[model samples]
Target chain A: MTADRGRNRRTAALLISGGVLLALFLVSLTLGRYPVPLWDVVRILWHRFWALFGLSTPVVWTDAMEIAVISVRLPRVVMACLVGCSLSAAGATFQGVFRNPMASPDILGASSGAAFGAALAILLGCSARFVTIFAFLGAILTVALVFLISARAPGLRVVNLILAGIMVGSLFSAGTSYLKLVADPANQLPAITYWLLGSLSGTRLASILPAAIPMALGLVPLLLLRWRLNLLSLGDSEARALGVNTDLLRAVLILCATLVTAASISVSGVIGWVGLVIPHLSRKLVGSDNRALLPCSMLTGAAFLLLVDDVSRNLLATEIPIGILTAVIGAPFFIYLLLRKEKTL
Target chain B: MKKTIALLLAAMMLIALVGCTKTPNAPDAAGTRSFTDSVGRTVEVPNEITKVAISGPLAQIVVFALCPDRLVGIAQKWDKTAERFLATEYYQLPELGQLYGGKGEMNLETLLSSGAQVVIDVGEPKGSIREDLDALSEQTGIPFVHITATIGTMGEAYQKLGELLNMPEEAEALATYCDAQYARITEIAERVDKANLLYITGDKGLNVIARDSYHAEIIDLLGNNLAVVDSPSSKGTGNEVDMESLLLWDPDVILFAPDSVYASVGSDPLWSELKAIRNGTYYEVPMGPYNWMGFPPSVQRILGMLWMAKLLYPDAADYDLYAEAAAYFRLFYHCELSEADYDALVRNSVGKQ
Candidate 1:
């Protein structure tokens, strides 16, 4: 009876957060430095919906209003939700696979490698699109290197992976610093620093739409395999006795998580704290079961980032990089979570 | 006893004479004159300024233009493109680094050792500039002077620079040119129909110079700047903006910064939706040794003003573009600009013919 009650509560938490996320998305679409009437936002979206089905409607709203709603706010809000959800879900998956609460999506050097690649692109004076592409490739390459070293080494696979990740991550970080040292201090160095701090101010529909494909590819697998994540969270020997292929499952799960992480960071820049703090926050809301924790983290993260991004772009006319807002908000909320008296995860 | 007294007296006289002898590269106390800088700080500057150092790129360009031979070390090295219009010897001057920018601080050791008499800071004065320069001067034992030069004040800045450098005639010529050009731009700006203008920058062309920002001085003067935001960024990168903002601002005319999305925006489906791009009103800012607009916000901006005025109001600004550009190149860069040179410079900006 208790287990059933626990399940019901978890389901309710999921629905509540999911509903909150949808509400936040709608609200975020209406907010920007450029003011559009809420009615116009709704009208423009409705008109576009019908237009997609080969219907022409009279446009009551000005062209600027339509463009602001469809072109600017919609893509930015959507990208924020996508990035936030991916990072948090990836973080939860990493923690479960490693059975370490401290593990984050970038534990395997994804963020550092992406940062290094972006610095190199900036140094070379590559365009924004190339910089995004380079960062994504850099992340994938770093994770692949970690796996290669772990698989070849004559030691415990998990331990080897962790150690290898640290070593590779450091190497990429050093490379990024060197690029910064050589970058044109007037322009390129600041560009690299801004990218490191992260921002969604530059998101275009064209850029985010292509990136969504890879994010979806990674996110779907993690959702389908989340139940197995519970078994994997158990000790390796115990999981083996239960007939789960611990090695193969761990590899597949990690690859998907890295993919999600890489895609999230490549477009948005290196946003920290969300992957680390949001999963823990999710654990507090829902019980520690992977089934409840992963989805809850995803829904909560989407809402959390959307709210922060809205503040980032609107708090000042000049963009305060979204990464900065996350750290400032994420750090304080984490302190409150730590002080609370509760059953620990 | 008399010999001992005579010897002691001679030795004392010798020591006094040695102290009076001038130190190499040291300013004679008598040679320095009290000169009031832009911020009202009275500085003792050398009378016959033979060797000058720059605190940043702004000063480097202004000083190099006024008295190229007197420059001891350039604050920043000119890019390879500078070789086309600038003399090889001038462009290859010792790079002593900048004082206030993100890249490298002014190397005091280098400036002092190079035997430069004074280090000049140019352009608009920051809030603490007087104190900053004062502190730097006190720390390094090198005298520093700042000359305030906004788009409207270039003539005064040039005059102040001339007096400090002791080249009154050359300074007067440049100053007169500046004053005349300012009047012409004012005339053009007054007569021209206001076109809603947006200055787009960055690799992705997602950045904009907000209205009234330092980088947009020329744009604001020549056109109706439309990128007004709550807080304008002081940085050269301007503010990061999205395409939606551009569409909403709906500027009829657009200026793309060099090395931005100008080369690709023509083919991009999303960019083509913009009124400026679709109407062919967007043009890349002309760049060579330096951007023709106001990134440095220095002497080049005078040229940038003329070029911008011409682009905005061709009828009121009906003076020959090539003739004006040739005169500027000859005076500032000391390089003769042939018809081919003039054509090549504006090729990407104005497009062929």
Candidate 2:
């Protein structure tokens, strides 16, 4: 009877999560400058999925609507989903690894490092693509340096790691400040400022692929270790007694989280607030059991980001950067979460 | 593995050769150059500077005219916006961020990475910034050059920069053009009474130049009786004046920049009651390449003055105004004047009071 109940709960969770994602996807697709009817959107999605397989079936207006939906809106929505999922997953993993729920991706100096790379690239005439590449490289380098500097053994001490990240992040921030000071007032400064704010436009397939491949590689191992993550969350010594290789596990998770965070940042620039807030929300919804929490976090994050990005792009004739919009919405939500969590605790 | 080794060796040799070609030791204008800059400073600008970085928009324009490929960097802002306004073909050149403003504050690592031989700053040096500039120049082994921001300084700056880059003739012609325009404007203004002029933007005092400011110097050349508004120290904090002050200083003729409250007075309820609006003596400012009349301090503002003169005193001269407009655009902006770009420049040279 207990087994049956457990199966039923899992099934229900899966169904609800899938339903939320699908509903949010539909809403995102429909809410744009050129609003398509429900039937047209369904047809458009149908045509896009089929067309990819070299199938030649054309219902009237399917081609244009498909282009509008898939080419124009789909990449942005998909990117938001991917970035959101990765960031939240990384955040959850980091918080668990560190035994600190307050942890987020940028806390380890990754965003600051990426911002420095991007600022340098702009100063040197490199375009958005190179900016992403350099930023990812900087993030990877920063994480490596943080790990190296903070490691008491082969793995990191949580407090030491945080301290090293703060040190490195501040150094990079100083570099960025220097770049801003010397930049031309008439032209380059505004562009850098806008880029730093983080727009999701001008992201081509090429830019997306570099980030996506690394994320996929990182996420696979993570999904496999989801059960282990729950055990790991019960403090490091408890995790070790339960037959987990705690040091190896910590390193792997940190590397994976860094990969996911860096990949997302490369394509999307530095989007803040989502990673910090979504995992907490996931925890609230399904409790802090990593098994349910990880997947739920991903789902909630994907849906929330898509909803935010949709508002960002469609609310005005000129699209506000997703980073700014996310903060505007999420900061208040996060404060609310803290207030609610405080009452419960 | 052997082939890879050989290829790497070849690449290293090529890089060395490229490095050597960058430092051509050209002599300065005095012939027996003392290897010293102005302010009695000793600095080493490698003979032929292959890699250079510029700080200002006008400075970048000057450098581009001299050597298109030599610029290694600029302030980030130049790389984004103003470079787009340059003829489309020149957009593909390399840039470095504004490593320094008028004073040189560059990343030594970034400068070395780009292999810049000299640094060019395009404005007057601010306090303490000059010291930083000197320090950076010494540390980076890149000679720093400063260009002034005067009426005829663009030509001189360009020519000197061109000479440094082995493109003197182009720079000379540009300088001569600027000199002639300056001379002509001076000649024209000397004949008119410099007192009766009223400047406002739409219904507000967005900006005003008094007889003491640099803006006043340019307006003074227009040969008009300057009617000045008493701008308080608290108003617009030295950039603009209040609308109330503008109404109080109502004069015979009102000239306005684009989108100003002064221009809107003919239609504005508060301003329609003003004497200038009632007499139909309002004018809309001209728009030209780089916002000539809108921001009346660019070299293009000379064209604004000629247009203004034609409108205010139509009986004053028999100048071929369109020809002059066409010539100025052709010479400075390096484009054949479209009738629209020209008309837009002079159309509402000034608007309703």
Which candidate ranks first by DockQ, i.e. highest?
A: 2
lDDT for residue A297 in candidate 1, whole number 0-100: 96
Error of 2 at B135 (Å): 42
How far off is each candidate at the interface, as Cα RMSD in Å? 29.6, 20.1
Encode model 2's per-residue lDDT on A186-237: one tens digit a residue.
3345556766776675443344677789988888778788888877778778
**Candidate 2: which stretches are off by over 4 Å?**
A1-11, A62-66, A152-156, A341-345, B1-353
**Candidate 2 lDDT tens digits, B316-345:** 544777787777656665556767656655
Candidate 1 residue pairs in backbone clash: B98-B106
lDDT of 1 by residue, A1-345 (tens): 988888888999999999999999999988865557898788778767876865444455543455556655687799999999999999999999888988988899999999999888766656667678899999999999999999999978888999999999999999998777555445566678888888775466677777899999999999999999999988899999999999999999999999999999999899988998999999988878988999999999999998998887667434577888899998998899889898733
Listed in order, each prediction's TM-score against the native is 0.54, 0.54
Query: Which consecutive 10 residues in model 2 chain A have the weakest lDDT in total?
Result: A56-65
What TM-score describes the B chain of model 1?
Answer: 0.90
Chain A accuracy as TM-score for every candidate: 0.97, 0.91
Q: Count steric clashes of candidate 2.
A: 43
